[model samples]
Target: MLGFIESVFLVLTITEFILGNLVNGFIVSINGGHWFKSKKISLSDFIITSLALFRIFLLWIIFIDNLIIVFSYHTHDSGIMMQLIDIFWTFTSHFNIWLISCLSVFYCLKIASFSHPSFLWLKWRASRVVVGMLWGALLFSCVCTMSLMNEFKIYSALTRSEDSPNMTEYSRLKRQEYNLMHVLGNLWKIPSLTVSLIAYFLLLLSLGKHRQQMQQYSIGSRDQSTEAHKRAMRIIFSFLLFFLLYFLSFLILASSRFLPETKIARLIGVVITMSYLVGDSLILIFCNNKLKQTFVAMLPCECGYPQPASKGPFAS
Candidate 1:
């Protein structure tokens, strides 16, 4: 039987899974529908759509892995299944994070008022640049997946040699192997995190510079360009906040292996990670004008309830 904490974690994971899928699905459908009719999509929309699509798969992979872990006692051949799950999880997660980083880069190039020759040159070729980044991300994921599979093979071989004479030594070695695998699993995320942080700081710097220029030109009135900078800043800031939380939760969950009592900490980590999946999508929907409009229109109107006015800083 599952413990109380485990039961709660299960429920929360399911709730977030469902909510994350809905918001991500909404993003895909809206952008997809527009593309189908128009036969084209903006580079930013294309990236967002692809990111949402990968996130849907990533969420399913995560949910399935969680279920397997929770019920491993009742299951046979779980190790092989887990190995397969890890492969898919790694690929999907890599795509998700790298795409987000690409989005940040896209935002910086498109919106940031930079006059540097290199920045202007990249902005002019933004679509090709993002495509190249996506391909590079795919190549990197392939390498990481191959490395993980190799590790899994070695670990499986160790497990299969359980009849060895040095049982104590085997146990210690197994523990060490497990720890090494854990670290290897998480190490791939660091590059993506670094890229995202760099893009975020660049956006921040651009926003600051843009604001300074606006202050000098304006006569106590905000202009459209100023509002654009603010909106972009908000979106990127939210992404940075959620991405950092997600990364931190992974670290906490990884540390749970060394702690004597880890159920609570592990559960907390899982919850926060799931929150990032759901919360980031919600922020994107609310902050993007088309998404917000479509989301509000989809809600059923009540006779007496006041509909939210569309006039806000978020409005495009």
Candidate 2:
């Protein structure tokens, strides 16, 4: 029997799962089809496709996790399975964050006007730089996964150990260790978040400099470079907005573990976390020119009216 909040959470999760897959699948199919036909993909499309694919997997993992929680499927014997799921979740989540940071870096290097020799060097080899970042992120995620697995092993061993005469003390110590490990696992996200913030600030600086130059030269406000900078900023800003929300949801979920009575907070966290995928994908679609064009083309028309071509929702 589902309680009211559990029922609502289930409904929201299902809705988000369906919506996320639809949007993310659209991204993959469009980009993948283009790649298949042309045998090449733009670096932006490649990153977008990869991010959408991982997000699809992340959605599935979150959906299953929510189901487990709502249904109380967790049991003593299910520990190993739950741990495996957690590892997969961690890997995908880490990649998602790092890939977003990589995208920010890519946009900054490609669009920003930076005069530094290092910036010029990176801009010339942007593809290689982005690819290297992806590989580095992969290696780092693998290390985190391994660390989590080791922690799980330690926790499992502790769980199986015989109870000491001071049972209460031993139980308290185990609980503390579990909470500590959870916090440490989440702390791994900070480095990627820092990278994203730095990239964002650099882009903002470049935008400001470009605007000042335009003003000094009396250049038109609707020039290509200005539009490019604005578009990139919109995309990055949307990413940051949803990423922060997702982070907040994680905090709420973590707090719910400590305050077991706050079932509503846990449910809300799960809903918000799942919503991030759908929200971010929709933002990408509207912000990216190719994606927005393709999405508009896919819509049905009525009354014998031709659909207007999309130049991106964020276009000036």
Candidate 3:
């Protein structure tokens, strides 16, 4: 289940995303494409797009690490590989959450009304600095969490336990460490989710206001408005689905640990995290019409699938 073969598939996923972004990266360099034809391509758009690409790249790394861990479970019980595995495990999990948070922030910026004027100075500025700050925020949080991480002794047999002979009375701090780490890890999620909800509400109100005018406008404009609404709806629905499933799983996880009585609750927690991670790409792709087209086009043209090319909502 784990070996060079699985590693290859992991590489495939990363390569696929890298290729996808590079194709889109053209939108940034040598005349950024019509991805945002409705508005001028400014530094913000460039940064947002770049951040989106970076987030996907992070996901690829996390997936590849998971595959490596899967392989290690069956391969030789080692010293070097074990240390690498532990570091990868901590890094992937922490960075994954941070990247997702950044994505959510970028999406909010894209949909919100712009107030800043597009100046050449701003447009030509560096985007990497902003991205680095976002990542730094996540890195800080992850580092803070290390202080609270629960520790258990690992043996050459690939087994870990707090109750093992190696875990002496002096080392018993599982309950305290678990609670601290869990709380710190989930703390950022609250503000991220809150911002999303507030932004969504404002978005709904704005959409509602546009609806009345959409009826009075000319046929061409009205059709455009209608299409825009549809696109907004797709994004909103995707966000809602993600929030519902993710929050439910988070609640179960917290409850299980806090209550310490419901064994099923812990299992449900694992299921939720797994489902959310695997489905993250699907959620993003399905929410954006243009992204979906890119996906279909990357597949063999011989299949003749109906990959709808989109720029704006009304792109036909």
Candidate 4:
């Protein structure tokens, strides 16, 4: 007796889960193989590998959470299962977001041009800076993940204590706990979102300026480099846009959590939010020549190569 909400959730979950796993799994496997053979990888490959791994875990947690909500709500609400699910969800999700911000920063460093002294310095030491940022992101995600777990624990306790006989003391404790939870949930996200937006803006500005310069010397058709630049910008913009949408979706889902009647909003929010991982990975494959080539190479082909099309009906 699956209702509309459950049906929709299942459809989106199955489609996104399969697509996300395939794309991310491909990225991870190819990069992993390269790493093994070369004994190292480029910074971009490292970041992609790390991101794909995080995404795979995040998608799994999302699937399990959705399955529990739709099929085993009674079991999920009781005892320690909810807490464990919350922990893994918060950790994997936050880590995925942080890594994406790191990717944005890396792209800015690699692609954008700035005349400021600090920008010049960063550009000079971009590799080291990116490495340090990745480590910092990992550490920060761990701290934030633990903070989320604590906030949830405190919240459960606060709910129970709301039945206490002392009204004033309960009010004070409730206010303190509410504020702590608010800060804990938002502290990491605000900074990461800000950094992501800043990177997006700077990259856009740099590309715009570059495009203007290229236009000055253009005579006929668009050159290969200009087209490439546009393609890169488009890819970045698509990824950033999806990230922003995912952020908003998560916010809606979080706010809707308290409103028991807003089932539709929560369901839609989860579906849209999960789409980001799949969409972002698709963008990476589309934008990067190497990844696109690798994916094409992996596709099954007759005689290990694409065959020319025939005019007949049963052409293979």
Candidate 5:
């Protein structure tokens, strides 16, 4: 039953990934949603959409692993192919966490400039620098994980070595290397996740100060500022929930000595992962009245396009 739910969330997450990308893609430069002469993609736009792209790629890799596990049932006997796939997964997970950390920091600086829009000029240049570094680090981690790809054991009553019956001496040693890399892979997650969360809180505090200054303005301006702030706040919490649940999975694994391991760890992991999709989607669903009303107004025509005029409190 728990696996069934995670499966559903996996589907839902991919759906979000696709739709969000389409939104980021089709969003026109002009406010009226005309395709004739759309706005050019600015650096900020590229950076923001890049974050969604990162999430989509991350989820897709994890989805592959989920499929492999379900189909193979953890037999753990695939050769080089499976080993390489595991390396990809490890690197993707690490890359996703760090990329999102940079994103959180980017948002902090972005929001910090509510008063001085010129401040974002530096971010435009910084985006390229950050993206390059992120790719380099991800590649480095991928190479490191490959070092552990060949390490595995086939323990049996008659088996004398850590190597399997069919595994060669080189394969056996490679397996040892792979095992070591697994520990190192997980070790990186601890710092990556910690950095991501720390950025979240610092960004939140920066936003709080920004909002306070906006409070002195007219109701109309203040209301717009409030809406944007709330949206950012929701995003911060949504990511926090995603990472928090993931961290708890580690604790669940550690508790295996005193508690049943597989059932509880897996069941809870499913719950945590699903909650991210459900909760984050709910934030978008509840907040985006324009998206909802647009569909309603275009019921007999092309549905899901933005309405000609939206009365959403947050609509610009």
Candidate 6:
């Protein structure tokens, strides 16, 4: 039964990874298609396309890492592949988080209405703000990855001299370096999380105000614009929920490192982490009309997926 479960887990993980890549690839392809037809793409499309690209690479690293962990448990050595995985994982994961936050801020700026001078200023400079955020994310990710890679090189060198006369000292130094690097990695994640939290809070405030204003109007008097606002609010809430679940699962996964014997907790964490890309992309596709239409058309006829009629809840 234990073996059976592990096999099932591996299969599910690989399946989700493949599905996520396909979905993200579809997103990138469609965006590319649009760019080819039209000379320009919107800022939202630019962010979404770049986000999908990062997620594709991230999912690839995750799938490879999970395969090694699950199928090659006897391999205790941390070699160059592991080092690459650590660096790429850190870079891609941070990049993905930052992009999501940028998307959230973009949405809030586009959807929310506020009379404050700051709000007006932000609304005017939303494009520049997103571009700045993207560059900042890239710079931070690069720094974190390079720092980790440097530590990893030292760790790898120490690992190679396991049988040396000073083996004990080397091991101690490696452990200390690893711990410091881990802490630094966690520190690098702080800004992304802070940005995301701020965006989420601002979106929540906007949604609340919009809801209250809508409530003042009669249902019979609500227009398409009101419906669009409600749809945007729902997408923001859905994204927030996804991020909350992801962070909770990430904490659990990180703690599992200390409880090496708790395979179940680690397994659950891996599964949740792997699902984030596919799950979030699905949310985005369903919320966006163009992506939804393209995705639905690509589905097999036997799947019985209904064509979306108009831009509403499930329609897009």
The alpha-carbon lDDT assigned to residue 58 of candidate 5 equals 49
Worst 10 residues of 1 by lDDT: 302-311
Put down candidate 5 lDDT per residue, 1-316, tens digits, no spaces.
3477556655654565455444433222222243234554433334333443454454455445445444553553355555555566556556655655655554555444434445456445556655665676577567656645334332221134444466577556654554444444456566666755755675566567766666655334445544555565566567667767655653453342245554444435434543443344334333445433543564587545544342322342
lDDT of each: 0.77, 0.82, 0.48, 0.73, 0.50, 0.74
2 or 5, which is superior by lDDT? 2
Indicate whether candidate 1 or candidate 2 has the larger lDDT.
2
Candidate 2 structure, TM-score to reference: 0.91
lDDT of 3 by residue, 1-316 (tens): 4456545544554555454445434323322455445456544344435534444454454444444444443342245554454354445444544444444444434443333564223323324433764668567556744633332232322243444677554334554554455544455456546645654664565566666666666434445544555565555556557656766765665566566544445444434544554455455554555555555667676465565444552121
Off by over 4 Å in 6: 74-77, 153-184, 211-221, 262-267, 300-316
lDDT of 6 by residue, 62-126 (tens): 78877776777545136667677777888888788888878877877776678899998998998
| Candidate 4 local lDDT, 1-316, one digit each (tens) | 7898689788998899999999999889888998998898878778878889989998898888778777776575445776787678778777777777777777677767779999989989988988998888878888877776666666677667766666668756775865456434744677777777888788778767777876787743364444544554666577668878887777766665455665666667678877988999988775665666677777787234444232110110
User: Which is the better candidate, 1 or 6, if ranked by lDDT?
Assistant: 1
Off by over 4 Å in 4: 75-78, 162-187, 215-228, 260-263, 298-316
Clashing pairs in 1: none
Q: Candidate 2 at residue 78, lDDT? A: 52
TM-score of 4: 0.82
Candidate 3 yields a Cα-based lDDT of 0.48
Instruction: At residue 39, give the lDDT of candidate 1.
Output: 93
Which predicted model would earn the best lDDT?
A: 2
| Residue 197 accuracy (lDDT) in model 6 | 69
Residue 221 in candidate 3, Cα distance off native in Å: 7.8
RMSD of 2: 3.0
Top TM-score prediction, candidate number = 2
Ranking by TM-score: 2, 1, 6, 4, 5, 3
